[model samples]
Structures are given as structure tokens and as C-alpha cells.
Target: MSPRQYEDDDAESLPDSRFLLPQLRDADTEDVEKYQRGGLHPVHLGDIYDGRYRVVHKLGAGGFSTVWLARDDTEHRWVALKIVVADYSTSVSTKSQLSCHAASRCASDAVFGFVLERRHFTLDGPNGRYLCLVLPVLGPSASDLSKGIYSRITPSLSRRASYQATRSLADLHAQGLCHGDVTTANILFGLLNIDRYTESDVYRLFGAPETAPLETESGETPGPEAPKYIVKSLNFLSSIESVISQDVRLIDFHQSFLISLPPEQMLGTPAEFLAPEVAVGLKASPASDVWALRCSIFRVRSGEGPFSGFEVTSPVDLLRIVIQTLGEMPSSWGDTLFDYYGQPTKEPTKGSPLEPVVETGRVRLEDRVWKEDKKKPYPPCLSDTIRKPTATKINNSYIDGYSYETDELLEALPKISENEAALLYDLLSKIFVYDAQKRPSAREVLSHPWFHMGEL
Candidate 1:
């Protein structure tokens, strides 16, 4: 069965143990009951894998696998050991082959380093056989770094990071491969010479693993299949400054596929980054990847995504936001109609003012005319009026769509200069088009002036 189908099948076969298992207070840890057969293999600190790798700390976990920071005794280096759940263990060879192909294609260049699978092995456990892939240790993801007070990085740094990320996608596309899922979470910062640090140094730098004991509501000790304690993922790297300066590594190719052979269904992509075409049940392509890349760039520069704030229960909800934000969908989509009024009259064509327009003079709050018809939310164009009192007037002619909470949410983003913001807006507009064919290629995105405006 395909991975997509396998997910459905697994869900159907697995018993719902919500009432059986004890409620875990730490939301960061993985589900404790997922320690049975065909689920997560129980792994703990100091556990030896394949007689070579020694698990030291937990990196993170996902729906299908768990990543651990391990020390390779034979190679004497730090490596990320990604252990795939037994249910999907059969596909490890295919995943490994794809990684090798990508690595070989970009072997000559070190700038756009594709994720390479260093080595892989199989292990027997109470949960069943597990496929373990060893890879180079990477730092925090772009999404993790771009949060809290450090939401927005320096413009130069943002430019440099965006250029490298687009270049990596260009290389992959040139090789006829598409990173089906291209979100900020998949782009990680590369740690320089990570193996040089001793185990003690690693603990001191990233802090020791934070763990809590697992328990059963029935007051019985958990079986051997379950881990004794749950280890919290070390989401952020301690060296913030160093992390921002390092180059980026595009990781996670599980959803990736060759352009010649597209999957029937695309799985694992974040709802906010799903492209219009893909969200409408169309097959993923290089063009779709470019669309997702544009969204990722927007989020990297600003704290939040373009289509955020709405509770996205499914891809259709996200598609609605896309139509609401970017205007109506193309006729080619066929019957995917959504009612939206007061859309911007001017499309994001060349020389158009797509960025938020702010007026020159300030208007006092009391003197300003508030729309008495409170039933209809104010248009996005007028959002700046409330945020910046000085910039009072907004040309409603350019307004797009009825009131959007996303605009207000965007107002809370870390401030960037007017010039830089305009440049970035222009770049996003060029790629955020509804037609996939009209969107710029990954290579063309590299040549965009936004990436060249700053020192990067």
C-alpha cells in the first residue's frame, strides 16, 4: 500500500486507547500508548542501537518516526538516528535510495547540500522491526528559530537564507525531483563540525534531556514495550547567534517524488503551506513546490504565514483562505467556487502597489470615521488606519476581499523597513499567482531582486 493508504489503514486497525492510557501532561512528548506493535519503538537514554550508536538525547518525533541524537562509537561522531515505525519499515530502502540519488547529483557543490543518508540499519524490538537511518546532526529548524522575540531576523540574514533555500530547490528541480513538502519546519540550520564536541560538551551546550516517567491510570507499571520515561525534544539550539549565521540544510524527503512519477496523494505537508492546485486534489509538481517556497519565505521573514489565523481543520479550509487572500480561484479548478466581495481591483501585476498602503498624514482616533455597519468587518486595505494613526487614508479601490483577521494578525509581525518590505512584497506577489504555470521557477526566484537588494 502507498504511504497515504498505509496511514488510513493504520488508523483503522489501531484501537483507540484514549481512555485506557494515562493522560500525558507534557504535550511536547509523543503519545505514550504508541509503544505497541506497528508503533513507535521504545528507546531511552544510554540505549545502544546496532551495537554502534548510543542514544544520548531526544531530537524530535513525528507521525511516522522519532529522531534521536546519538553518538557513533565506531565513527566517533554525532549523528541523528531517525527510527521509522515498524509499520513503515518496509519503505526504508526506497527512502535511502532517493537520498543517495540526490546526494550524488549535488556531490560537487557544498553550498546546496541536500540531506544525505549516511547509513541505515534494522533493529528488533517489542514493537517489531524498526528501520533506523543515521544522518548528520542538524540544529533547530527555521520555524523554531523564527519564534518569540527573535521572530524576524536581520534583513541581510533573511536574504542570505532565502537565497540558499531557493538555490537548493533549484538544484533539486534541475535533477527532476520535487520536495513535495517545503515548509519552514523542513529547513534546518547546519551545525559546523558538530562531532568535535564531546558528549559532555553537548550536554552543557544544549542542556541535559528533560524527561518524565510514564504511568498507567490503573496503577500498574508499564510494559517493556513502553519507554520508562518520556524525553522532551530539544527543539531549540542554545547558540542562537551562531545558528542564525550558519547555512541551511533542507531535510525530510519522505514526501518527495520524481517529476516523472507523481504520487496519487500528497501527505504530510502543513496546511498553511499547501498550494492552491495541490489543495484542490491535483498532483504535486515543481510549480507547486515553488508556491510553497514563496509561503515559506514569507513566514521566515515575518513571524506568521500568509494564510494563518483561521482554524484549518483540512486542506479545503486552507484553500478557502487562499481564495479569500489572493482572490478567486481560476476557472480551470472546476466548481471550486467561494463567495468573496470587495476584492482588490488591481491584480498583483508589475509596478502595482501590492504591499499595505499607508497614508502620509496622521489622523486622530476621535476624528476618524469608523464604519458603523459593524456587521461587515473592515477591508484589509484599512487595517493600517487602526494600527498606524498617522497613516489615515487607504484607497479602498485597491482593497481585496472582505475583512480578514489575517491582516490584523500580520500587523503584529516584527517591523521591517519600508524599502525592504516593499521589495519582499514584490517578490512574493510574483510567485503567489493562482496559475501554477505563471509562477516563477526556483531558478528564476534566485534571480529576483529581493534576494539581491541587501548585502547578501
Candidate 2:
């Protein structure tokens, strides 16, 4: 058998297969087919980039980029190297310009931690030129930390993290920048002195890198454009207390844009956090950011967003869920529906006026007197008619096929304290409106009583 083909009995004595192409079962790894043109750039475990940063292990991968844990030989420190796919390499200049401003602002204020680009370079590959960014090594995302049976942090930690996240947004909004995509996954915990960790320490903390060979469907060897094997991303293992105490840094600016000059295309924000206005063909602004912030706050406190349980296959589905949870869409947004669908002429039924139902009265037990005889002792049968409470109609006539009731959507929300729920409802009510212009700014959100319920 070839050296690349290993027998089951000889697995233990085989040499390092990092560079050898070996076929194996599929594991949780990035799509190997993405190594083609305009996709992910193929990289190996020990490959050196720009003659300085040496790739140590994989960090993670997204649709547009792959992040690696590398040691900067020049500085003798560990750093995260994000290699952007050739398709998105054009945005490097825009990101670089924004990073400069962000870095300067962060230097002035040490309290807020924003992941600013330390340095960046270009590398020519088989697919195309790729952009590589050097950044500080950090801990796991808030979403990962808050995931489990409980699905949330302590109330105090949630409050602090929420406040810090709002402050981060306020800072960005103050600079005329809108983080187009704001979600729990982008909120990362800051780590201290991670650069001081040696290779042995890294192995001890994160364990050895797990990898699986890359093989084509036809059982042929993959081209040079693809790596021999795929490396599984490492998960940051740390104590809950440590994660709770650490500061949060807002990372991933690929979707971010200036509020004054919004992007022509729709942002790539997750479906769950997509603002109502944005979902209905509107540009992202600071108000949209506020909408996403409220959703993120909800996720931090509860395990998921209020609308997470509902399936959102399309933008219209998301709009339906939003309307089901938070009343009807504003009349002004009616025209946008036509624009979203590209053609429309059917007239929707006019929504009725919202009116509160009042209860007449409750029957008192004392009001009914019962008499019993000496031989036949039995309570009198009450024949009063039992009335069912009138269900409140949610005026969602804006969407043609919207059939969900208000109570149905509200019932799926994550459970929390009555007080917290009330505060959150008040906050969401103000921000979840269809009119993005009416939403409060992130700075204004910091002053809300929900942020300062009792203590920090």
C-alpha cells in the first residue's frame, strides 16, 4: 500500500500526515470544495505567511474568510490571521481605513475594546490574491459562552455585557459608523497576555489540532489549489467566571458601513437579528443597529431571540414573525412591499382600530346562597353561563398570508423574571417599530432603567 494509505493496525506507528493526502470519513470541517477560485485560499499547518507569521492551527471559518492562529515571529507573539477570500479582498482598503479610525479612538479610551486591524498584507495564490489581516488573539464568542442547557449568563453578567455592547455601538454610531451586522457571534471576549503562551502551553490549553483528509467525490487526488487535509477549528476552553469577568470586543467589520453613506446592497446580518425596516427593503442605519442591539441583549439575557423559535426561510417570513410578535407594520412600509416583490397590485384589507376589552364583573361565591334539607343535603347547581375571554386580534393585514395570532408568538419567548420581562418589553417596544427613524440611538438606550436596574 502507498505511504498515504494507512492500515487500521498501523495507525499508531504512522508518521505525521499533515502534508500527506489520506482519505478518511467526513468530520466537522470546512467545505473542501471551497478551495476553488473565488473561495477559501488553501493553507497548511506550518505554512509561513509574509515571511513572518507562522500558521500554528485553525481558529475558525466563515462564508468569506478563514481565521488561523499564528505566531508572529518578528514580535514573538501569537496572533489571529484572517485570510479573506479573493472575492472579498477588494474591501480590505475600506476595512483598513475604518480600522485606523477605530484604533485611534480605542487608544484614547481604554474602557471599550474594539478589534482593530493591527496589520494586513496581500498574498498571491492559485485562486487569486488574498488579503491577510493580523489581529490580537481573543477568547470564545459570547454566543458560544452563553450556549448550553441554561443558554445564558448570570443576570449581573448579562447586564454588564449588554451595557458594554451598547456602549460599543454608541461609540461607533458617534463616529458615523454602523456595524451593519450585530449578533452574539461577533461579540468576543478579550483575553489578557495570550501572546505570552508558548507552543506547549497552547497545546495543553487547546489540545492537538484535529484534521481530516480532503478527497474528491470521484476518488481522485485534489488539486494543488486545495490543502491535503482540513483542520478542525479549535474551541476556547475557559471557566464561566473568567468569561463573565472579561471585557467584550466587537469584531467583524466586513458588513459595517458609514451611516451617512449606507451600502447599496443589503447587509449580511443573520436572519434572526435582521431589523424590520431592513427586512422590507431599507438601508441599514444607526436605528437598524439599535434594533439588532436589542435582539442581541435579549439573546444575552435569554438563550435566544424572541423570534428565534420561528422558522424564517425568507425576508417575508421574517417580516411575518416580526408582525406577529410586535403588532402590525406601519402603513408607510406598505409601499415597500411592492418594491420587495417587484410587482404587486392586490389591495390588502384595512386594519381595524386597536381597542381594549373591559371585563364586566366576576361572580362572587357569597352572592349564591345554597339551602340543604335534613334528608337530602346537596349544594345548589349554579347554572350561570361560562364566558371565554375574547382573543385580542393582531392587526397584521399588511402581509397577505399572515395568520399567526399575537398570543401564539408571545408564548414562544424565552422565560425571564417578570420585572426583567417588563423592562425588556418596554425597551423592545421602543426599538422594534417598523420605522427605523423612530428607534432610539444606542447612546439613548444606555440611559434606560433596564441598564441600571439595581447595580452595575
Candidate 3:
């Protein structure tokens, strides 16, 4: 089989795949073996890869990949290098799509109102050979922005961020692409230069890594490496402090889907942003991206998403939250109950979380009720207010510990002009509608009154 064909099954075997810290490399034979098993490369403070980029410091790590800030010695610029298992790397078809997307636009474009630059190639890491992608170095993510300095994005900043995100999505949609994951973490601020702030200041402000050495059994200790360059002037941080109007870009397209591909092949998104159609087994589409966009914009404007207060322990709980937040499943979804080949459905697993969901098929429990979706199979006569559940034991595992007063989306939304508020509500409602067909396209969303309100 091709490398891409074996990726899904093999991803688990290489679970802890990340670049090994310099301290762990010579510790012992066991440490070496562990690094090999986890597919961690022997990357250290000063290693150069592909005869060009020099490792600077770690950016961050995920289960399947590790990103590092590297200086391109050839180009004399800072860039992000993301290393992943060869099997889990982007496929030929995906590369084609990314290339097509790249050729269709300039390196920096007015349409997107943001930068989206990337370059990918294969590299031989210490544990095993891997695939690496080289990308432009950018600043803190939108989630970082929200949780950091401002506590929450101001109303004006939120408007600009949402507009950029929607316009970016519209550009991708025009090419028939769906960015599978569209959350705050995937949105990043544009930075002019990494040299603008001192290393200590950058570490304090953005939490960039400063090396920490590990103790060795042999007692041959090496000191932490100092950064190659440091800035003497620190005026840039203050100058750019009020620049919330700067560009924001959507990123992390590893899970992105091509609309032309078979529905079964598309991967699911982060649970919190998963659309109703996706949870129920329908293929993800551009409309599903619209759903995620709405959720992201909501979190940006308000401090939480509509269903933010729910404690979702699994995919099933996510579905319950969807049903509770939005009304009952669409009437059109009834046709999706059949088997994949259009055959009759089999009986659902008994006592499963799905059991309660499917059994309560068309019933609309009171809109926006707390702890309502978990009740067991209901009786013919049921009172909405009663705490006692009938024969069914309500799954209280999804309890959200958040008090009502602390929910920013419900309580702390920034006050805005009535005209802007009305336009925002109408735009969000159109995308949040339960039926995927009824949801507006990304282009349609970009044209909404809220986006055009400045013109009026």
C-alpha cells in the first residue's frame, strides 16, 4: 500500500512523535530506544536540516507533529518548521490542492486580507525519516489573544477578525475546499518581525521556550544554548500594542477536506465546532465550515461559544449539546437514517448514549434548557421542570460546572450599536440554522449586511 493508505492505522504506533530535547539524547540506552519508538528526531539547539534551516527553539508540539522556530540561514529569515511522521504527511492529492491554491493567489493578497505561505519537503530525522513543512513565522494565535492581554477581544477587534476570517473562508470555498478545523487556536496574528522584541520579552509575552537542561548520570553537563541574535531596542512592543486591526489568518489545514472527494473520506473536526450534519454521519461540506465559522466568531465577539457551558465528554455528548443548542433535527435528516447503501437500519446498541438521541427523534425539548438532553427514554406524560427522570437514568456526566453569571457569551458580550447588533445576529442565525442546505455559503456570509454595514 502507499504511505498515505497506511497512515491512519500507523498513527497510533508513533503517538509521542516530537523533537527530542538536547538533554535526553545521551542520557542512556533506554532513552535512545524510547526516542526511536516514539519517532522523535535528535533535533537540538543548533542542528541544521536540508543544508539550509538552523533549529532555533521549539514552537509547540501536538500528538502527531512538532513545530520549531528555525532560522533559514540561506534566506536570513525566521520560519516555522513542522515535522511529522512520513506516513501522516500530506498526500499527493493534497499537495496538488495546496499547490493549486498557491498558484491562484499571490504570496500576499488583498482577497484574503492575510498571508498564507507554506513549503513542504521530506527530511531524515534521527528516529526515522519524516516529512517537514516550512512556513512563515507568525505571532500568538487568536485564542492566545483572547486569553492574554485584553482578557477578551474588544468589539471593534472582534469585528475586524471575523471579517478577515470570513473573507479567507470565502476564498477557500471558491476553490471548493473546506478547512476541517476552524477554531480560535488556528487563527494567528501577523507579526512584522521576530527581532522587534528581546528574547526575554518575547518569552514573557508569547511564552517562547528558553532552554532547560536535564541532569546527566555521567556528570558531563552542557549549558543551555543562548539565542544567536538579540534585540537591544524594545520600542516595537509598545508601538504595536494597540494594533488589533492587524491581519489574522486561518491555519492548520491537515484535516481540511476537498468537496469533490467522497463524503466517507472526510475527517471530523474538533468536537466543539462539529456541525449537526457531521455528528449524524453526513459528509462535511462548505456549509459545515460555515457552522464552525459562526462558532469561532461567536467566541471572538463574546467570551464563549453558544454551547460553551456544556461538559462534553464524548462525541455523543456533543450531539446532545447540538440538539439542545439548536432545535430538533431537521425534517430532511430523516432520510439519513438508512444504512450507507440505502438499506434499512439495524437496531441501535441498547443503553448507548445514541439510544436516547435516536429514540427522542422529533421531540423538541424546551429551547435552551440546562441539563435537558441527558434524560433517559421519556414517558408519554412528562413535565419539563421535574428533576426526576422516568425509567431512564439521565447521564449527568455532561454537567458543566460553570455558573450562569460567568458565561461571557450569555452575560459579557460587549455592548455594540443596535444596527451592528441586529446585522450580526441575522448573519450568525443564517449559518447556525440546523439544515445544512439552508445555511449560507461562505461567499453569501461575506456579503451579509454586517460585513457591508461600514459601506452604508
TM-score of 3: 0.67
User: Best-fitting candidate, measured by lDDT?
Assistant: 1
Instruction: Name the regions of candidate 1 deviating beyond 4 angstroms.
Output: 1-14, 18-27, 110-112, 148-150, 239-245, 336-414
Report the Cα lDDT for candidate 3. 0.56
> What value does the lDDT take at residue 220 in candidate 2?
75
User: What is the descending TM-score order?
Assistant: 1, 2, 3
TM-score of each: 0.77, 0.75, 0.67
lDDT of 2 by residue, 1-456 (tens): 232343453677754432333343322355555687887899999999999999998888888888999999999999999998888898865866674675466536732557877889988998889999898887767776553222246566677778888888888888778888899888887776776678877777666788877776666777878887888787564221122234788888888887788987667787778887777667788888888888888887765576665565445556767776777778777655322222222233322122222322323322332222212211121011010111112243111111344345334434468998899789878987877778889998899888888566
C-alpha lDDT of all candidate models, in order: 0.69, 0.68, 0.56
Worst 10 residues of 3 by lDDT: 382-391
Compose the digit string of candidate 1's lDDT tens values, residues 113-187.
567678888989998999899988887677765532223444566677778889888888888788888998888
Ranked candidates (lDDT, high to low): 1, 2, 3
- Which runs in model 2 stand beyond 4 Å of their true positions? 1-28, 102-107, 148-150, 238-245, 337-415
For candidate 2, the lDDT comes to 0.68
Q: What value does the lDDT take at residue 351 in candidate 2?
A: 20
Q: How many backbone clashes does candidate 2 have?
A: 0
